[model samples]
Target: MRVLHIITGLKAGGAEQQLRQLLRHLPPEAECDVVTLTSPGLVADGLRADGVRVRHLGMSGNRDLRALPRLVRLIRAGGYDLVHTHLYRACLYGRIAARLAGVRAVVASEHSLNDAEMEGRRRTAGVRALYLLGERLGRVTVAVSPTVAEDLRAWGVPRSRIRVIPVGFDPALFRFDEVRRKTARNFYGLPEDAYVVGGVGRLIPGKRFEVLVRTLPHLPAGARLLLAGDGPEKEALWRTARELGVADRVVMTGERPYVPDPGDDAPGMPDLMSAMDVLAAPSAMETYGMAVVEALAAGLPVLYTAAPAVSDLPADAVPTAWHVPCSAEQYGRELLRLYAAHPGERTVPDVVQRNSIQNIARQTMDLYAAVLSDAPLEVRPR
Candidate 1:
């Protein structure tokens, strides 16, 4: 099969990361290519390094209709048997372009329970009309979690056209590694004895990073904060840290390299995950917390906001790892509790395997094949 994947950009995030993982596992006989509606990102660089063909359409914003023709040309030239897209920009343009190019199979994924990132304050009546138009053009849509599926249905998408498929994390890349733990800590300038409470995502308002910052003063001494990704909120977060008088204790390691999925076949990610004492993702909204699962795979406990999207994680998997009511004080209390318990010392490695990328990819490929088999979806009236 010749598959073409499309997205707004290749920047690091749950959808992009999961798409990259899925591509790495394509069967030997299949060919894969990717198109980014906007300029390619650091993650796309890794994709190109791994021999995947990636094209950047240079979209000048949401209204870049000029890129549509280029996209149409690429699809026609590539002769893709299937076109899979992620996020709103890609879904809107990719589906129409693939259809114009006469590709019979098209699939798109809804990576968030809310569409705020893609549809901002200009979410006027005209925007909704346009969105409904684009959505109606796509053949099938994949939701990363049931919450997302429910939200899509509520937004008028036909239930039959949607499929519930969870995102996958590579188990091998996330396993416990004592040697790597020391190395990663050294690389980050963290003391070997320090308790590291970290998160990996863009420092943005929607992520609720301030909640983590607010929780810092409550943590015991020797506890440090790490935000691995970067974004518009970098300066804001730094200012917040300074205002809170914990700037020196905070480590803002700007965006890092892409960590390939940790399935046995992938390399390096497991070592990186092992370096952390605990992973905290206090996002206000996340379709699927890929990093949370990655932390779980590394045998590290996770602290996250109580969103339905993250509720799928098993109970007793780690100490205070599941979703809880949002409160910086409460989050701090849970973080401290998890730190004291050292849950991984009691949990088995197999607990992480249940949500590995290998299994997720298999399920995704199966869903793709089913959608391609000409079986009509159980569509319902909106």
Candidate 2:
């Protein structure tokens, strides 16, 4: 089976990373390639190194009308058996292009639903209309979480058309290592005895990373806040840290470079997680908490706020994850308690069995086969 994956851009984001992981585990019989609607960023090089073909559409802007025909021509020329799309813009354009190119099977994945998309009732009508149109064109719309699937149904997508597929991660990549942890702490200039609280995500308003900054001052003197990711809010977050008089305690590691090596057990996120005492995800909204799950895989306790990806999971699946209130004070209190508890690592064999890239890729390939056969897409309950 030949499949073409379409996405807005190959930037370092949850959806983009999920796609790369999925591609690495696809069945040998399945031939897959990727096409980015805009310029391929850091992920392009990694995908190429993995022997996956990547094409850039050079979409000028949101109103670039020429991109539609260009994508249609590319799809027709590629003769892919199916087209799978990720992100909003890619879903909108990919569905239309696949239809125009006479590709009967098209699947689009919905990764998130932010507040901006649904501020007022009337404002969402246009967005819902576009989504409904895409659902009509595509064979199926994959939701990364059950909450996301519910959101899709609320937006007028038929229940029959929505399939819930949780994003998967490689446990081997995030396995904890003591030596690497010490090295990583030294590399980042973090004191070995300091209590480290880490947050991994884009430094944006929606992520609510400022809450972590606010919580830092309330913690013990040696407590440090490490944020791993970057965005437009970097300068503002730094200013907030200074205003709060905790500038020296905050470390913002601008976008960590992702080096994808399936077999090589080298230091990356595993070392970072090992060095940290706990992971804090204070995002105001999260469709799926990829970082939270990865932290759990790394055997770290997590204090998160309304992470549907983690909350929706069965209690037995993630015992280490604690759902906390969004307030910084509450986060600080919980961190203190958790620090005192000094939670030990629990075996997360269930996480590896259910969320490994291999299992998710197999499930996805099954979905593709079902789509081709016009069979019902079974929603796997966790």
Expressed as tens digits, the lDDT of each residue in 266-320 for candidate 2 is 3355577777889999876788888888888777888999687677867877777
What's the lDDT for residue 59 in model 2?
Answer: 97
User: Candidate 2, residue 339: CA error in Å?
Assistant: 2.0
lDDT of 1 by residue, 285-365 (tens): 676677777777776767788444347545544543666556798789888888787544724346557566778778667
In order, what lDDT does every prediction score? 0.74, 0.82
| Model 2 TM-score relative to the real fold | 0.92
Where model 2 places Cα greater than 4 Å from the true spot, the runs are 114-123, 257-267, 343-349, 376-382
Candidate 2 has its poorest 10 consecutive residues by lDDT at 114-123
Rate residue 176 of model 1 by lDDT.
82
Candidate 2, lDDT over the whole model: 0.82
